[model samples]
Target: MRILIFGAGAVGRVLAAMLSPHNELDIAARDPKLSLIEREGIFVHGAADRKIWPGTKPQGIYDIVIIATKAFDIIRASESVNEFIDENSTIVSPQNGLSHVDILTDYFGHKVILAPTTIGATSTGPNSARLVSLGMTFIGSSSGDMDREKTVAKLFDHAELPNNISNNIIGEVWTKAIVNACINPIAALAGVPNGTLLERNSLLTIAEKACYEAAEAAIVNHIELTHIDVFEWVKEVMRSTSENRCSMLQDLESGRRTEIDEINGVLIKKGESNGISMDVNRALWTMIRTAEGRRLP
Candidate 1:
């Protein structure tokens, strides 16, 4: 199978390394990383280890196309993938929030698979990524095609990518979003790693409130959560990846646009519509927006 992973940063680097050895893999990447891969190949370490060379351009129509860009880039990224998609292409989205779910589904219909990975991967440098924890991936289609869902699951299994075929993928996706919504924004605002929240009661309390707010919103909206208690799951993630900076923190520190809108912004919309108030999420959302503005031009 030919697979193309668009956006070769962090999670994308780790995925390209994992999937390349088993399939004809191609990756879409920018400047130095693209040239670096062409010259030195990609090295993946930590939880999953591998070193493989990946092409910078697609050879032909890919059986699977993974849109690995940050949530902010989804709308534009989805449009660029059209050339690589044919009648049978499967578009996999491993994004963190539920925001990009409908956009990709509405764009590609059944071929779009909502895949959310909890893998704690970060780009170490120009040509490498370290997987802090090998989090499981949940795979299912927003269009609800079980057959295609299983097929993609089988493909990942063959590629040595850890995953589960979810009957309730939206729920699974929401579960990840909830954990991220609770943790990422607070981490970004506080300028701390995830583990720091564990030691600080104030931050942990804020995260828990955000988690509870989002969880209640999920229940109110009738979205089933795979995790019975989301805050516990978030704490476990924080412990396991203690030293790693959350993506939101990384984005904020680098002066890049954070996915607060993609993560918290979407949650606020859902929670407000459900009349959950979502005060915690809204506060973090506003702070992130203000920070983003300060970084602009």
Candidate 2:
């Protein structure tokens, strides 16, 4: 099956290479990055494997369309690349935080599949990725179609991006959202890696509070996730990528737009809708946004 992977950033590059051996994989991205991939091939270095993509973009109707971009870019990227997708296509989002499914479903229709990949990757340079870690990715459909979810699961296993088929994907999404809510902003704000918070309970409490509030907000939307699950998941994520910098921190360091607005900011908005005060998350959101603003101007 022909597959088109949008983004070509760290996550996208790792995904493209991981699936390269089993299918016809194409990396569709910005010009310079695309040009680099076309010229030098994408070099993937890390835990499970390493390789180089020496050529070509996939053509025609893609059987699987994987989007690995940040949450903020999902809509515009989908709209811009609509021509590459046909009715038979199954779009998978391997992005972090919640709301990817709703946004994709709104634009790409109900055929969209939600995914959260734990395949940790980092870009050492433009159009280059290192597959630093391994973890299970979840796949499911928001429209409650088992067939679509199954198709995505089959491909994920085929490509060796370890996956679990989830009936409670909304909950899975929010679980990951809660984790990102705690880790991403704080990591960026303090300019530290995930493990840096391990002993910092004073600051860690701030993160924990945000997780509790976000979990509560998620429950209001019928996304059932317990605070314990949130804490355990975040702890696991930290241990997994203990040394790596978060994507949000990477964005801040690079002076690029961060997904804080989508991750924690999404939770803040959800809290508002439910008449819940996500004051701590809002405060972190404000801190990250201020950092983001500094880079912009």
Candidate 3:
């Protein structure tokens, strides 16, 4: 199979290393990251270990096009890879929020697949990514095409990525978004690792409240989430990736734009538009926005 990963960030690199051995792959990245992979190859450590040398860019249509760019950068990434998508191409969205999946649908139509993953990994460097927690990667179709989703699931299975094909990808995406909504903002503002938050009752209380608010907001919007216990989910994630800093925290520290708007902001907007209250989640969103303004140029 031929695949193209549009962005080579932590998630993209992790996918590249995972899929490279099983299929012919190409990475769409720029400068340091692109050149680094071409030179030293990609090294993944921690939960999973693999090394991949991306030799050259492949030509022609690809079977799979995974859009691993940040939520804010999805448009640019989608546009840049538009020409590479053919009728049979399957585009996957492993993004953190709900809006990005819609944005991709606008650009690529029904080819867009919402396949959010709970796997925790961070880019240690341009060519090195460390797997923090090997969470389940859920693949589901927003367009209700079970066959298509299962086909994508096969690709993941071939790559040995822990994944499941779901009939409710939207719920999965929302569930994942709320989980991030619960931890990301607090973790970023507190300037602490994920594990520290779970260890402290005060932080856990804040996360639990945010989770409840986000869940209420989603329910009000007519979205159905899976029957997973969110508070327990948050605790398990914290324990799994104890020392890991989430993407929002990483972005703030590096002065890069964060995806608070897409995660917490989504819940806030839904609550405000529908007369639902999302106080705790709204507070987290406001604080993260203020931090982003101060940190980014």
Candidate 4:
């Protein structure tokens, strides 16, 4: 398969490394990292060690276009790669949150696939990353096309990456988003790793409040999450990636904008639309935005 991945960040690099050996891979990224990838190739360390594909700018239409950009950059990433999409091209977005699906569907129509992965990875440098934890990835269609879902599942299987096809990907996406909404901002604000949220009672309390709020919002929105115990799921993730700094924490520490709006802020908006109170989410959203403002010039 010919694949083009946008945003050579942690997850992008990880996916590129995973799929490069089995498929034709191209990475659409900005320089000087682009030049570095072209020169040094993508290297994975820690849990796995290998040199993946050398990055290149995509030209012709590709079999698959993976949007790994941050939620805020999805529009730009999709537009930038629009020329590379054709009728047969399958666009997969593994981005965190719900809004990217709407954006991708709007642009790519029924060709869009929603892939939400729990694999933990962190970028060590421009063209290098470390795998923190390997977890199941769920691939499915928002439109419920089982054949297309199975096709994408086969691609992951061929690459030896763990994945499953789901009839309800939107539910899975919401479940992951709820977990992210609980842990990410709390970790960022506390300046701690994921496990720390579970370790500290005060922090865990905050996360629990956010989790239930998000759960209520999901219920109101008619999203049937697989996890009956959301808090337990969050705890499992914290334990699994104990030492790993979440994406939100990494963004804040590096002085980059965090996806507070897409994660927590989105929950808050949904809560409002559903006539539910998301005070905890609202508070976390405000706090993170304030911290981000202070980090700015």
Candidate 5:
């Protein structure tokens, strides 16, 4: 299989390294990082450590194109690789938030797959990454094609990546978004690791409120997510990634724009549309945006 990972950041590098040995893998990166990876290959640490490169810009339609870019970059990344995608190519979005699948499906139709992953990873530098925790990734088609979902699951399994085929991917996607909605911003604002949110009663209270609001919004939007208790799920994630920095916190610390808009912001928007109150999410969204604006030169 020929796979093109559309970003060389933390998640992308981890997936690229894991998949490169089994299938032909190519990373679509930009500028200095692109040049560096082309020259030195990708260096992966933790879980698996090695340098590998399937090459770049190879001619032919890719069997699968994984969009591992941040939520905000989905459109630009999809457009950049439009030529390499065909009716046969499956585009997998392993990004956070509920909006990316819609964006990709608008461009690629039924070929888009919603992949919600719990795998933890952090970038040490450009073209380099470390896996923090191993977790299962759920794969399902945006159009609900069970065959396509099974195919992706098989591919991921063959690559030794943990995966499960989901019959209700939208529910799963929104569930993950709900988890992010509660934990990410609190972790970002508290300037603490994920475990801190669970450890501190005050922080945990705020997180619970956020999750409740997001859950209410999901219900109003007709999204079924009854499989797991939201609060317990959030706590489990916090415990599993106790020392790991949530992506939002990482972005804030690095002075890079976080995915506040897509995560908490999306909840606020959906809440309004469904006539549900999202004051908690809205406040967190505003706070994160304020922090982001302060970093501007």
Candidate 6:
């Protein structure tokens, strides 16, 4: 199968390396990055203990396009993939945040599969990614058809990426949203890895409270996520990914725009639309932006 990955970032590169062994893999990204990967194959460092780069262009009409861009880049990235995607093409997004599936569905129609990956890998340098935990990755279609979803499940399974298909994808996405609501901004604000706050009662309380507010907002939108349902999942993620800093925090450190506008900011707007208040999430969003400004010219 011909596979193309958009955004060649940490997650994209990790998927490229993992999938390249079994299928033909091609990666596309903006600017010098793609040139680097195309000219010298993708260089992966840290974790997995192997520096392997697949040296071939994916031929024929791409069968699957996996998009792993930041939430803010979803629209442009999806549009860019149109050249390669066809009627049978399946697009999978392992992006963070809630609006991504809807955004891709709007652009690529119902052929898209919504995936939330906790296959913990971090990018330590340009064109380099480290495999950390390789947790569960879930997939399903927004339209609830299982054909494409199952195809993706078996694809990842064949590649040893550890994934499954879910009928309750909205709940699954929102569950990850709840975890991101707590971990991403808090990690950015504290400048610590996600697991660091697990021992800090003060930070843990704040995080749990934020998760509560997000869960309530999601429920009001008919999203059906219960804090009781996702509490242990959240705790497990924190414990497992304790040493890694969130991508948002990494973006801030590198003087790039964080996806706060999509994650926390999207939740705030959703809450307002539902007559609910997301003051805590809003406050963290503001603080994150403020901190981001300080790193400016």
Judge candidate 5 at residue 224 and give its lDDT: 90
For all candidates in order, the CA lDDT equals: 0.87, 0.80, 0.84, 0.87, 0.86, 0.81
Q: Pick the candidate with the highest TM-score.
A: 4
Point out the worst 10-residue segment of candidate 5 by lDDT. 288-297
- Give the lDDT of residue 230 in candidate 1: 84
State candidate 2's TM-score. Answer: 0.94
Instruction: Please estimate how well model 3 matches the true structure, expressed as its whole-model Cα lDDT.
Output: 0.84
TM-scores, each model vs. reference: 0.94, 0.94, 0.95, 0.96, 0.95, 0.93
Clashing residue pairs in candidate 6 are none
Ranking by lDDT: 4, 1, 5, 3, 6, 2
Candidate 2 minimal-lDDT segment of 10 residues:
49-58
Evaluate model 1: give its lDDT.
0.87
Candidate 4 clashing pairs? none
Across residues 1-297, which tens digit of lDDT does each residue of candidate 5 receive? 989899877888888888888888888888898888998888888877868965876567899999898999989998988888888888888899977877888998898889898888777888788787767798988687777788789889888899988888898899899988988999999999888887899999999999989998988888999355888988888898887778898899889999989898888899888888899898899899999884321
lDDT of 2 by residue, 129-170 (tens): 667786779887878879989888887788777899988787
lDDT of 6 by residue, 158-193 (tens): 888888788788788888888888889998888888
Between candidates 3 and 4, the one scoring higher on TM-score is: 4
- Candidate 3 displacement at residue 56 in angstroms: 4.9
- The C-alpha RMSD in Å for every predicted model, in order, reads 2.0, 2.1, 1.9, 1.8, 2.0, 2.4
Tens digits of lDDT, candidate 1, 46-73: 8888999988867679899999989989
lDDT of 2 at 221: 76
Which candidate achieves the best lDDT against the true structure? 4
Tell me how far the alpha carbon of residue 2 in candidate 5 is from the true structure, in angstroms, after superposition: 0.5
